[model samples]
Target chain A: MMQEIRQQTDANAVHRDLTRLPLDTPAQQAEFDAALQANLPREAAVRRQYGMDRRTFLKLMGASLAVAGFGASCTARPPEEKIIPYVQVPEVMVPGRPLFFASTMVLGGVATGVVIETHQGRPTRLDGNAEHPASLGGSSPYLQGAILELYNPERSTTVRRNGAPASWDDFRAELAGLSSANNANIRILTETVTSPTLAAQLVALVEMFPNARLVQYDPVGRDNVRAGGSWLLIRKSTPITVLTKPKSSFPWMRISSLVCRVACATRGTLWPATPCAKMQTRPA
Target chain B: MNQLFRPAANTIARLSLLASLLAGVVILALLLVNDQSPYTRASVGIAIEQPVRFSHKLHSDQLNIECLYCHATAEQSSYGGIPDTHTCMSCHSQIATYSTLLEPVRTSYATGERLVWEKVHDLAEHVYFNHSIHVQAGFACETCHGRVDQMVVAWQAQNMTMDWCLECHWEPEEYIRPVEEVYTFGYEAPEDQVELGMQLVAFHEIDVDRLDSCSICHR
Candidate 1:
């Protein structure tokens, strides 16, 4: 029955245009007749499986509905609901009104600034932050969908060590033990450090240990763009994207170059150039 | 063959038919009574218990504290907000510091746990009501709430059914008063209430035609 509906839907799509135009021609009439004829047999088979005529089915349905209605009317009262008021409400928070906070979400080294709407304390919705250079009141589908990730059930909710559940203190103690060893090769693997504070911390960590290194790795990294000689240069604290015209006439190269230019221009100081490179090459 | 029925049988049949009709009428009357009863409505003079028994009579009547002092959002937001525990402690901390009755309020303030207050005038989820709009339109708080200053415990005074809402929506001029009288507990409507209300409605630019539209409240 499901397969029959799907076939009918597919057939309907093919004849969708035919509906707008009049079936004036004999050929058009014949095509419509053919589509209808194809569906009639399956529909007849489904009706036969039910083994009840329209009148009999209606009578049965009416009788059952009357019984259900009688049963439902016996219970009149709805379940009681309670309203819990905050002990010490925040100065800014009003019970019914939603509050918005400016934040950033990063995916594949690209950061988008967003304003999150929170009810009481839980984040409910996300929109583009109007003031941020990365978004400028416009958001991509990725930024809009980032709110779902906060409540994603499959997301890792605890620290793990060697594929087993571990506490943060345990991880910290182990890290301290590892760092105490003078010749330890501590490699911190992260996905795109965009925040200035995080980059500073990474730099400080690398400086602390002579052999320590930080590697920013994304599955869909812009290695091709870097190889294509599209560099985002920071001159006088402002990012300038000098799009060096593609040496080759390849379509992908041109598209990549365009994306690089847009990413660099809109991204601005979101991904700082000096600190990012310094953190990467300092240990090396 | 003897007759299958006697004259007495015909009377019995007619009497049975009349009894069935009477039974139907009695059942319908019972249903109507149930529909209008306070037990079914679960509101209108039903004072739901709260974690802390806060008295509006003492606060708003004796002390003469404004309704907006605690329910501050009523003038601005859709909800007549239940005051935070902090709002209660602001005064209770100094005045009734060690009162046994205020133990819940103190516990909530100290432990940072919320006090679950049962709603007295709960509306259906589908109905969209904005207290700010009504208050701003010179609809007195007492008009629907009914002398809250006199009640020891807060109870819903109005049924707040769709029909009750339509009574005002159809003829708003019968109820609307001056804006200043909105928060007043026992505001008496002037003799020329309809006349003043008509002018106020025009002054507020309220479109009477749009009031009865389904989306006005349902949405």
Candidate 2:
């Protein structure tokens, strides 16, 4: 008998934190509300009456102050604001409406499809594209934070070599010189690439230089299942395993399996209510 | 005579206080009223300057080109994308390539840079407005944007406040039109507009409750 277990540890995947208080019932909500109310300032009765907390009331007050300050400044004799109209307006762009473009965000060689919201010409926000298979309308944190990265003031605007500014033409000319040297002692190192087109390009580059070599280094390493398969042959041992029956047939058994802890059930499976409490391992 | 004068003085003081209170109320009301006035609404009537002196009046009214020819994304995406430089060169390459006015366009095309057009009807950062949903819901381009077809220099027509958006969302029947008539400028509502609007709302499956939620526009 042999057993192979597949485990998913994609850090980008959504995981519910077990340490957080679970508010699954109305009782929990009422308890939380009570706790919040107990800590509220005594002077915030007026805010509470309007269904607002002290924090929200303070925020509103701050916003009012900011607005008043802004309004006072605006009333002063400032330079006249100019309105620049287009000489030839594109038919598609409305003067004031935001536009969305379908784009992809890559993290660790995996691409997640996202929709980029552009105001004027700058990308302002990123939302998961529902049409894309990888995202399914939910975005990872990387995709959500991409807009800040786009607007980051400290991001590189030009190519650099050894902390000095460089240009693409200069780099290309340098590469051409090296290629003409016929130096067979070339080594190209890259992170794990999943795209076939990129792989093909790397292969072509290696072929162009007869002695050139390409090496892929992945920080996360390869799948453990493949590693396990090879180890089983080396040891020549059989691993005993037990598979849980359908939840309808054996509900208790299904609930006890550790796999049931994280894997959502698609058919006749009940979600473990108590987190780790339901992880029951049985002898095969 | 002294006691009588004291009462008179008290009455005068009371009357003056009341008069001043009324005056303050009037002044505040005037300020509030002035906020939405056409003169106070920035860029409402003023012609905005552009890199190119493009006239909507000439292209839309004179040339008879459809609004969608340039704003192709409005029907499918949240934005009506500004046309690329090629879109300009498509016509101006042969029409007015040598004109001083077309110099910027030529330079942008030659250098592969974009002409940054000044935005006219920009909304606040908090509000989430989708152009496609309105267009798909049978709203004419002029419904919120006013008449761009006649604008020599495009200007803001609507106040574009939360109250203005809520007023329409609460009573969308007045604004709802046929999908085909959505692009039609100066579209008039039918005589039984309220009843027709009710039917259209139901047909379109527009959840009135959902539309009125804070999250609908805020996030």
Candidate 3:
């Protein structure tokens, strides 16, 4: 295995003409031959003394079998390409034929309701995934068509190291550095998280790194909630709310699409329906 | 220095020099090819192999067991689904109760453990999955799901994604609902799409005009 791996490595590593050797001079060949001869087994050397007689015997025995089996495979050239085309790829392959699967799913938002679909897998057309309780079998198109956003290909691939490839060790080292910093000085920001376990872990990390701090920023802030969540500690507590509009990790605008109106905090407030209107072009 | 010590030291130094030279040459060649020094994390951590060997075709074709008996909730639940240990226990407890094929399951029950069945379909984090709706709406557990009774150890037969899913929903009748013959492991008409589309349009009062809107799903 080691020899095979070395051969592969040499094959891959040497891209130039290898037949013309830089080191295999006549003297070097003679030296290699002498070294090889010195290492040959004594039994093999004795067998060589018997010379062509034994070879002739083995050659006669091998010829009969080789002649019999060679007939079928002699002229076979491998086809240019081999394709195991699916024997029956479903006649549903017809262009006009549309097949649908009714699977239930959730529509993410302030409401975050369940929905059903009368969709193909793409939601080329939509109906809710009706059986789920939240949608109550009736669905709006927003929840029905969300499947399109899932496959948009623009999702972030979790790249790190300022766009350079990075090792998990590098990530761990950076995180360790951040944790080692003063909790009050280090800021870890996130949207309102639902998992209790995650919340507990965050609290533990916060206590461990007293100098480390957290900053929560919502793109679309619920007027009163954002005001309160932000001011609680501009330097400490994780500011989170349902409609302060969590920062979604979706690469396209679709990530934020799931965030609903801040009806709880905005009922009587002056903020517009779409919060994008509220963000300043540049921070003052 | 003595002759013995000097000769040994010279060989050691020469071998080290050769090894270092080869290492440097390899590293330099990689650098020229723009090869990264560090490899990336490209996959997840947890992967477990299944215990039993089961064939879908044998159960589905030979015994004629329905897909839903094992799957149970392909159309009615959020999980297209995996039968709970009890469900497996229900039948195996009586039929084929003593077989080694069912022995591992017995071990799980004795230990109060869940047999780690490897999941075949892995959906994107963004999409939702449900089974009850499909089952209740007159779809056989076999249609979009593929045959399960035929499988001993369940394997994913279809690519489950948003596009493949939506295409199934747009006109379900083609892939679904022959009514009398619910389990379809065989061929059907290719034009069933338009036929099913028209049937769905009539069956459910969906306005075809607004079907393609992103808000139908994105929200």
Candidate 4:
């Protein structure tokens, strides 16, 4: 019914276009205003509820008053020189000085540990985990920019359902439905997760679904690394053998009279934090 | 007569409009907070103030209390964890009962709150400096911490930059990895790293071909 009403047009739609014309000059605009003023008495029954009562109408009047009073005794006075009295400076504040503290960040997804530098309350930058698996102890350039991601104003705050704000209860109900439908046969599709407890939880969840199959879908869309490893060893346990430095850092590796790969490989053995290279025989 | 009546009515209407606008502005100012902070630092830096003027001289020299006695966790965690109010209260709870220095500690304890300690020494945001790894590896609290046992008010000793960290690491024997000779305090190395590396190689039968690689440190 509301849609149908919106589709219909008012009898005054034709005359409304006349008032909508953008008069460029103040004189023309004033004439238009005068014409509007002339019609006000006719529309007074409906116009009293809005228009003059609208803040926009008041603003229009205020602007016009400012323009009208531009000269004569109404000439603008110079803005008040607001001498904001200074507040007492706290003894602790030294304007240019910043203090740093060491903080830890959990590595998400494929990355290893990262140490963060916190200045005041703001996380300023990421350093290598220095002692964690995956990254070994070194940080990649990609990991360095995580502080921006942490403080990004545009990051999503809450989950949404369709276009509506979803409540925790509503989400739980959806999950419950999914659980029942699977009926002791559920599959949690994930990559090569090395977490033992998580695998156990997945098995427990599968017990709920009658025939749920946990399909392994590598998010990288590659499966060469997915050929099941023996229970004795995990793939992640092996350190990166050919830890190649970023090309910019080691251009000599590509074009040198003396090839630099062996130096890079040997350097990894000596230094833990630089470009740690592994045997080239291993697939990167 | 018409002109005189029109101007009077217009003036009254316009005055009413201005009054309404002024009222709206006041309402908005009440609704919003002024976001601009005069100081970029936190709470005008008041939150970062030291609880007491803890002297390294009186504790480290006069009483011979080890630097680690006060900042006990420096050798264990990423944070040389600042002693909580309770740690201060352990002694101050009785020893300095009447002193003005212990007043804040007592007040914090009575209120069931923690001390908000102002840190003096700081490191860079991009560097992941470890306390335990360095401590366990036999680096003194002073090497990177810069002679805190001698400081009156523990201030940052090292500039703690990438170059400084790398400089120390580059010559591991001088500043790092060589624990036996660095600390004058006679802190012994738990395991000789070079000897351990050798023994592990021999026992595990790990050839140079199968050892921890560069990915261990620089990811």
Query: How high is the TM-score of chain A in each model?
Result: 0.54, 0.49, 0.34, 0.40
Q: How well is candidate 3 docked (DockQ)?
A: 0.03
True contacts kept of each: 0.64, 0.05, 0.00, 0.00
lDDT of 4 at A19: 49
Q: Interface RMSD (Å), each candidate?
A: 12.5, 15.3, 19.7, 17.9
In candidate 4, what are the lDDT values of residues A130-228, reduced to their tens digit?
Answer: 565435556554567667888887765675676677788897787788875655444466765546777798888667675878876544432332233
- Fnat computed for model 3: 0.00
Global CA lDDT computed for model 4? 0.51
CA lDDT of A18 in candidate 4? Answer: 40
Q: What TM-score would every model get versus the actual structure?
A: 0.69, 0.54, 0.33, 0.31
For candidate 4, the per-residue lDDT at B97 reads 88
Predicted model 2 interface RMSD:
15.3
Instruction: Looking at model 1, give its docking quality level.
Output: acceptable
Kindly give the stretch of ten consecutive residues in candidate 3 chain B with the minimal lDDT sum: B36-45
Please provide, for model 2 over B1-219, each residue's C-alpha lDDT reduced to its tens digit, 9 standing for 90 to 100.
112244578899999999979977975676676666655545566677787898898988889888988776688777755666777788888997799988888988887666777877766668888898999998889988788899988887787878899988888887898789888887778899989988988889988878889999999
Instruction: Encode model 2's per-residue lDDT on A1-284: one tens digit a residue.
Output: 12222223321121222113234478864654554444434523654578765456788999999679656744632234433435445556555666789987754455667889886577888877878755555555456777898879777788676678899987778668778878656788877566789989999989878889888775654334335646977753322222333455666544334442232221111122122223454433
Weakest ten-residue segment in model 4 chain B by summed lDDT? B35-44
lDDT of candidate 3 over B1-219, digit per residue (tens) = 112244577899999999979967865675433322111111122222466555666667887767777655454446554555666677777888888877767776667566665554554445444455445555565665455555555655554545666775665555555444455666464575668746754675545455445555444
Best by lDDT: 1
Runs of candidate 3 exceeding 4 Å displacement: A1-284, B1-49, B147-153, B169-182, B190-193, B206-211, B215-219
Residue-pair clash count for candidate 1: 0
Top-scoring candidate (DockQ): 1
Q: Tell me how each candidate scores on DockQ against the true complex.
A: 0.28, 0.10, 0.03, 0.02
Clashes of 2: 19
